[model samples]
Target: MNKFLLVLLFSTAMLQAQTVVEPDSTGVVKSNDSLVVQKTIMRDTLKPFKRYKAEGVSAVVGEYVILDSDIDKAYVEMQSQGMSIEDITRCQLMGKLMEDKLYAHQAKQDSIMVPDAEINGMIDQQLQYMISELGSEEKVAAYYRKDNIADLRKDLFEANKSIKLASLMQQKVIEKVEVTPEEVRTFFFSIPEDERPVFSAEIEIAQIVVDPKITKQAIDEVKARLNAIRADIIDNGTSFSTKAVLYSKDPGSNSKGGLYTGVKRDSPWAKEFKDQAFSLLEGEISEPFETEFGWHLLYVEKIRGQEVDVRHILLFPEVSQKSIDEAQKKIEDLKKQIEAGEITFAEAARKNSDDKETRNNGGQLVNPISFDTRFDLTKMDPTLSQQVYNLKEGEVSEVFTDRDRTGKSSLKILTVTKKYDEHQADYSKDYERIKKLALREKQIKVINKWQNEKIKDTYISINQDYQDCDFAGDWLKK
Candidate 1:
């Protein structure tokens, strides 16, 4: 479906679409059967498949049992992503599910604690994207076969907890992995010559960013406008949902009546906004409150503990041409200083850049994937990629408007500080790239060993129907 999930959760590419044959089970789905299973199969009342007394267990990893219904859910998720389904693919899928269980079991044993905020943040990001794409919360709910967006959010929270836990465990497993230059060379040469990967044309780019400041006048104007709308809602009895659709600037939330559910108090939302949020009682609409990105009026729909499900009407302070021009002027000045050698890009960035992360580091943009300052060519924004692709090293790009993390329009100029072309993988030139791969290989080896050991110590069982495919960790053996 939407590979738009921030994590590399389902990135396997265009495989042939194939159906997973239904395993022989007494649990044939009935006519009245619905796909509206709860995210969890309830703790005490485990195995809702009791009705399908015929529905057999696929595998059992410690306390976590993989039921026929669970496998069916996985198959449907894969099918949504257009995955190839065969015994091999099914085994791979089973392996992944079991890995999740293994990590979860170990995490509990090790007393690993993942904060609620972290999980809530990830879930919110995905929900925001899904809601934006689907055009409304109603659409998102319907797509997931949920009663509403709140239910969808609850499901996301449950799913993401395991994902986050497994991720944290994986990170801890590889924390100590180290690879030397010698190891990198040995690993590189170990690959068959014909099978060696061809390097893509890549470049290292840096930028000086200037956030367009929405003026005090714009803020006042927006505040006054929202005040009127809020008045209409409370004083004149206008529908809060109706006003949200027409006026809210948050694309992800506007069509949803500017509502979000399961918002954890510890989440990264602006503290002032969140502080005001939790203090409100249900059906209480607060006065206009200011956050970093404009003004908002809170309408608390529901609250449970630290989580608040609320609808709000957001009004972004409008930016005038004058505001845009001012930002452009600042970047152009910085550009001139760089061109004239009056100051270095690093110094200008430190003194003036609005981008916090890059400002301290010479305005160098890190590749989101590699988490390094090098660009992988293809991953760069198409417009940004094309512009710098044609420029020589040491050239600076013209200032242009780009969206920041919070979606604020900002003026930015990129500098091509370094460039590399497609070639055979070389230790001298591709040291970092090769080193990363080599290090990851070492980590994988470590993780695999740990996984095998865990499997040996933990109880595991697989149904005879699923035992044929190749499984790692001696799954079919010990």
Candidate 2:
């Protein structure tokens, strides 16, 4: 028989064996033997299970039915993420899907609520990512085998929501899992001497930035321009969205008519922006206000209890070329003073650096990914790596022009404060990294135990064909 016909025959076989058995007061099913207990739990869990009328149902995990096609789709997703799937097998995919379904099902049972707005935001981000990767909305829909972008979004929303639930459930299981210092040492020493990981060549860098001054006249001009646009919208009934599209300097929202949704008090927005947004009633626009990025006029589109949706137009004051030249000269002169031993580099940075994030910390740059002072040379940003490639410890680089994320230009000079050559990891020197590894291992064990226990309590039935595959968990048991 063909695979499809075989699946149909199995589905019919399963339908012919429906039986319901209730558990006792101790939450254990009464049965003749161990095998019978397992069978009874399966039947009890599937009391109201809907019978599949067609083929291709690979397994049933609690309330979810995994289909044969899901494995293929998963493989496609892994490929899109640049993962090598040559060593992976269909059985592995089936196990992973079962785990996700189990987590998602248990999350709902535990009343782990994922907000609709959060899921919708994730869907929007995913849609944008897919569109960017595939060239357009039309291409994304076609790639996903959907008739239109709406259909694609519907699918993505459901998929992303389930994935988020699974992730949250897993996090809850391991949130408190930790390892002490003793455990960290034990974990590191447990590895054989020859098997210890090698430390990569790394450097710790610091910098000083000087921002060009924006004159008061320039600031007033920007505020006046924003006020004029706001007045036109309120007085002449011109579209605020049209004005945002034409004038807003914030690239993130300008193209979308400055629309932002799900703005809560705790959301990571500028204090000024949120203050202005929350102060307005629906359809009310605010006076021009200043934020670190620029001046903005906020229009409250809607208020949904704790969350508000707002639209805005941003305008930043212009910096004159003379001001830019002056900033560059200031940084250059500071470099000379530091080189001549008149003022220490760190002292100069602490006193004069315009980069607020590092100025208070004496301009010391921390690697964001590692949250440490050292950065691995191979993994560092190409531009920065080249700048510091030849510099020795305590040597400062020539002043260079840099642009912030907002495209604001600044002059910067970097100093390599420390350097490390590749070497075997030392216990004391690598303690923090080793501690992280130990903690992660502890979390993994906790999650594995949780999964094993949940698998036993939850209802899961694998297809006879896939039952022979060796799985990490006792999934064959109820």
Candidate 3:
């Protein structure tokens, strides 16, 4: 049997029948079956058997009772690690389940539904996150004993959807919650000054960027070279991987025989790269193509659902000194115009900047920490930070060299747009911030109320074993 199928079956069996018994109340049954307890059992059964154990007395909702197998497993695992299971069990598991039950009940009451699109989106996101952490989907699948991500997607999707729905319900319940100016001040005062989070002093900056222009003829020449190479590989019966290893300029994957583990559309590779990879059928080779990274001959190896694996040989066209000199002179001329007031910095950026992301925003650089125009000079690029550290507001930086994430070097200039010194936060300075906090508090209350109502009405049943554990909400008497 497939490992994935086994997990799914276990989950279904665990949730199919569950009973809830209220603690400290006799002959008081609210509902007969508890979804919360059933779900918990499913999670426990799916975990590795070596770590399996039961923790805390169960809680009865209506007709359903939920159990904490993970907590039990943790207790037993800790015992194996030389900790006292009694102390750990007595202190944690039961309380935790009570909290989870309250939240899950609230989620159902608020009608927090996870749409199919949301589930699929989350699955993709998880897949990408796993790839980043494990280096590839193949490794992750091997570790989990699954054939592929699709086999695991359904279970992951359901679990994630349930958690998301619960979170949404919490938000809805707390929508009107708030902590006022006084509350903020009190909370701030309660914390020790030494422990307070220090706000970085920052400056706002802006810039104009340009790429050294590549002529159509130069691009065509590079593509023609790649085309020749691809033709040789196809006509000579040479393996694609061998050719890529010998000729590909993509330093990251070339050594691995130009093999790219499957990548999603958003997997940090350029859109052009992904588009070209997906366009080719498995085993099909693409003609030479030119992108920002120069020219490439791509070979699509396999298509796995939404992911594609490909190999490519890349060639970077060398930039001539004349081209660099020309670009530098143009930038210098633009700076002179700004200084002479022939064109305002904003106007110049709008008209000539190559940085599409920020040029339209008046070339103002965003603070990495706050994402606002404001930033602490200390947290900026070491070289650029040093320049801004010495400049007064409104000063334009001298021409400096920098490289982007792709390691492409370029010449650029920066202008300091705004500066803010450190100061204590207050209502006047942070009303919008305070309001958001207050609103979250309100939402929590609403969710709590909704949960109480749902538990009172939903069908729940706890097993006889959990009839005596104290629950936070009135699950048995409702």
Candidate 4:
């Protein structure tokens, strides 16, 4: 299966595949059941032979129960993600399911509240992606075995909410776990010499980017359009949400009528947009304002304490080919200057690069995933990795045009500043990497301890067939 299909299947797994047990009077559970069974079963098995019941209770954790069919579902889920299942056993899958439910049950006991808006927004995005890929809402509903899209959405909401709760619970358990430099040193030396990890060949690169300039005419035209939209809402009583659906350029929110709930002053929104949103009274619309995302008109629907419910329509000014050509020429000139020794690459980047994140730092690109200056050559972004693989240290590459995720185009030139050959891990040279690994180990230990304690206090049961399997946790304690 393709990546998107895998995502769709994983996201909707519980909706189409989950079978909650519903036991009948004869001690057998019915198939195609939807009710959640919470009662505990205490009988021991006479034989360890596998007896596959389509909907029999495989395990129960607190108020949640896993059906026998869920093991099959788990297999399908793993296969969809391109995982090798040859060595994976049914008991292992059941243990994972029980762990998830235990976390979710404990999350509720601790009063962890997942906002309805957050869950609803995720469901909307998932449905939109499925529909866009599968062609229509009808097709999406049928693909997931639902009678209608509404039913699919209902299932998605419950499953997604549970997922968020479990995830939050895990975060809460390990949020405060941290490792010191001494712990990192101890952990690094504890590994066997032969078993120590080999560090991959890595490169540190920097870039100089020049963006096409937007003319005043284009900016005014965009603002004029937004102003017209604002007038229609005020004079003709046109719905702001309807306008957002029809005209908003923000793909993240356009399908949802450009609505964003629970927005706060500290949210990672554009400062200009947030300022305008907070300044407006409920049911008031703000004048058009400019941000890095271009012009936007914001409407405040309501305010709840520190949070606000808002809707917006975003529009970007069009850039002409002439401007793009000028940007290309400008970057080419900078590259030529560096090559001729007229100016150093770092000096040019600091003075001329338009990329805000790197310009002030001498255009040195930081790896977002590792929060470090180095990127493993094999794991770097395909386009960037190809561009810098042949360039020697301090040698500048030919000018190239790059487009961001938003499809905004710019001119850029790259140069590798440093490179490291593959070698065995060194305690002094790889302290950052070692520290990260040590911290992860500490977090895992913390989570394991938390799980053990919770399992002892919670109600849990396992089927006779799985009782013989060696589980990581003591699931059959009671």
TM-score against truth, every candidate: 0.76, 0.67, 0.63, 0.63
Worst 10 residues of 1 by lDDT: 11-20
Clashing residue pairs in candidate 2 (N, C-alpha, C atoms within 3 angstroms): none
Q: Which whole-number lDDT from 0 to 100 does residue 365 have in model 1?
A: 85
Candidate 3 lDDT, tens digit per residue, 140-204?
A: 56544558866656545554454455445554554556676676666555545544333456778
> Across residues 25-49, which tens digit of lDDT does each residue of candidate 2 receive?
2222232110111121122111211
Candidate 4 — worst ten consecutive residues by lDDT sum?
Answer: 33-42
Q: Runs in model 1 with CA error above 4 Å?
A: 1-57, 68-90, 116-162, 192-196, 404-407, 463-473
Q: Whole-model Cα lDDT per candidate?
A: 0.67, 0.72, 0.59, 0.73
Screening candidate 1 with a backbone cut-off below 3 angstroms (N, C-alpha, C), the clashing residue pairs are none
- For model 4 the local lDDT of residue 335 reads 94
Question: Could you tell me which 10 consecutive residues in candidate 2 have the lowest summed lDDT?
Answer: 32-41
What's the CA error at residue 122 for candidate 1, in Å? 4.6
Cα lDDT, model 4, residue 471? 59
lDDT measured at residue 195 in model 4 versus the true structure, 0 to 100: 63
Best by TM-score: 1
